[model samples]
Target: MSASDHPAAIRLRQLSIRLGLGSAAFEAVQNVSLDIEPGQFVCLLGPSGCGKSTLLGALAGHLTPASGQALLDGERVAGPHPERGLVFQHHTLFPWKTVAQNVAFGLKMKGVDAATRQRQAEEFIDLVGLTGFARHYPGQLSGGMQQRVEIARVLINHPRVLLMDEPFGALDALTRLKMQELLLEIRERIRTTVLFVTHDIDEALLLADRVLIMSPRPGRIIEDLPVDLPRPRFAAAGSARFASLKQHCLALLRYDEPATSLPRLTPLGAPPAHQLQFAI
Candidate 1:
């Protein structure tokens, strides 16, 4: 379907996930529903252990839900598929492998020929701006560089949906800022659909087109706020409007009152470029 015909690249229907069984059972997510439009950058923001990662995994098809359903292109998500690409908080690079090799590894398993894999790997490496480091091993690279390789590895696959779980969480403040810019640049160039998870509201504001806030535990979506801030939002956190939105999210987080009902997604007006508010 066309982008307008199918607004959301991914959609969830009454999704509830319960881990373990009987006495050991715990519901990680309950009655959560969301729609992530194609080419949109969405962020899942919540406190630690609030199941943001679990919700991402369920959307990425890594974890199954106890009830409800997750859909991509209107089809049920059966299991892990190449259609979705994931980059975890911790870089999961093989230290023994060179940067280029690690990036090429996925294509290699897919039976892509050697020359083609190498060419594709090189292209993605360049895309992540890690061209010269191709031959270097992960051990030889700095933490930021290692994460770049992780991003390159996932991007090389050309997946339709990208799931990033705090990809820059391990970096220092300065490095985190740099990575954020790089991500926006790459996303602009590639137009990839992204679902990013982070606890930092400022990071979410900078990178996402929409921010979904989750309640404390038994994680359920509390707010689906549309961020109408213009692109190149690098220093967005410092902007007055951004600060306002950040405070709003924090208030929702700190409020102990239970949400009587889940926030519903609806078509709403765009927030003025310099003034931010949740699009109702």
Candidate 2:
């Protein structure tokens, strides 16, 4: 089926996840439910150990929900499927493979012919702005370039849902900003459903169509907010509307903590420094 006809919308019905067994078991995510529309960019923002990643894991079919269910369209997500692609903070590329080879690995395993795999791989490689480096091994590329290869690897498969767990988290500030811009550009071209997990409020405000804030441990969704901002948010970050939204999110995330505990938002239109602290 074409992507338009495919079951792309993701739904979670009272989903909860517990790790371990017996007395040792502890609930990682508790009674959370949310809907992600097809071709939407949704961000999950929370403090560390808040189970945002656990919820994402359940959605990606890497972990089974202890109760309730995660559904794509109407079908239960029982296990990993190619239709649901995942990208994590670290680059999971094959060290021995060239960039082109790494991007084509999935197609190769799916029994696609060599010619088709090479063609598609190159297309995605160029899509992510790595055309000239197709033959370079992962070791030879910068951290940002390696992450681009990882994204290209997943996108070439044409997944219905893309689950990103801080895919740009490990990069330096400048690289992270560029990657975010690249992601927005890519979404315009591919229009895939995306569920991105991040702890940075500004990052969430900048990229998401909607942001869901979760409370600390035994994580539960405390807020479901629409961004309501214009596209090209990188440029809009200094606007009053953007600042208001940022403050709103900050209030929710830091309600219990002291005001001095978290750093203030960067001034309007200022270049964010590499060492700016994120309110986790």
Candidate 3:
């Protein structure tokens, strides 16, 4: 039941979203308008506090738009739907639950039979390369492995649109690379509209079909750049074209920004709990 059959298209029309309450309230993203083709993998790349996650939250229905409209497949995205799966930087898996149980939670919530839920959960466990670890709890797995379980849980729902907010941002460098490769492999099998938020330019270049550059504070799409590299971009990433694109991205990110710090914004509008470091 993969969304490969018919992925969802996302459209935004003059969307504006504000964060905080009362005197602290301020626009996070402003007048954002864009159309993402069905099955397209688009990365929202920008500095911290640029509203990449805010816009993604709007699409995921975790946050409502202050103005304009957010639509998925021609319908309004007024609230959360199973078809729109959201993954965060950290795994929100229940520590008490086993991998299989966590992955099966969604199905169980939908009133699926236990036998059917177990079977489907097994399939996704194998899909994420965790075949023999079904009984393992979150505490037993590594950070990367826990994230894999989170991803399996999300994918088991067969989402038409996948919203990721720096899903691999917390992993070590080597682990992050492996996770990226794994993500590419998974996306090859399950076609869906992916809107990923990242501050790392290299990650954006390697994973996205197109990259959306956002501005600081009142974020807006300043640029929509396409990654024309071939798939399995390991080799392509070293080519001159990749370097050129990286340079352009650096310029865009570094343009006229002050040395002063800006707090990273989250989907929930709470103060940032962690700092984000940019990679050249």
Decoy 3 TM-score against native: 0.91
Candidate 1 lDDT tens digits, 17-88: 988889999999999988887888999999998999998899788899999999987889889976688899
Instruction: Please list the C-alpha lDDT of all candidates, in the order they appear.
Output: 0.84, 0.87, 0.89
**Alpha-carbon error at 176 in model 3, in Å?**
0.4
lDDT of model 2 at residue 147? 96
- Using all chains and alpha carbons, the TM-scores for the candidates as numbered come to 0.89, 0.89, 0.91
In candidate 3, which residue ranges exceed 4 Å CA deviation?
257-280
**Residue-wise C-alpha lDDT for candidate 2, range 1-280, written one tens digit per residue:** 1223353899999999999999999999999989888889999999999999998899889998889999999899989988898999999999999999999999999999999999988999999999899899999999999999999999888899999999999999999999999999888888789999999988999999999988888898888888887788888889876876687677777655543454444444566553333444
Query: What's the residue-level lDDT of 77 in candidate 3?
Result: 94
RMSD of each: 5.0, 5.9, 8.4
TM-score of 1: 0.89
Candidate number that wins on lDDT, 1 or 3: 3
Error of 3 at 181 (Å): 0.4
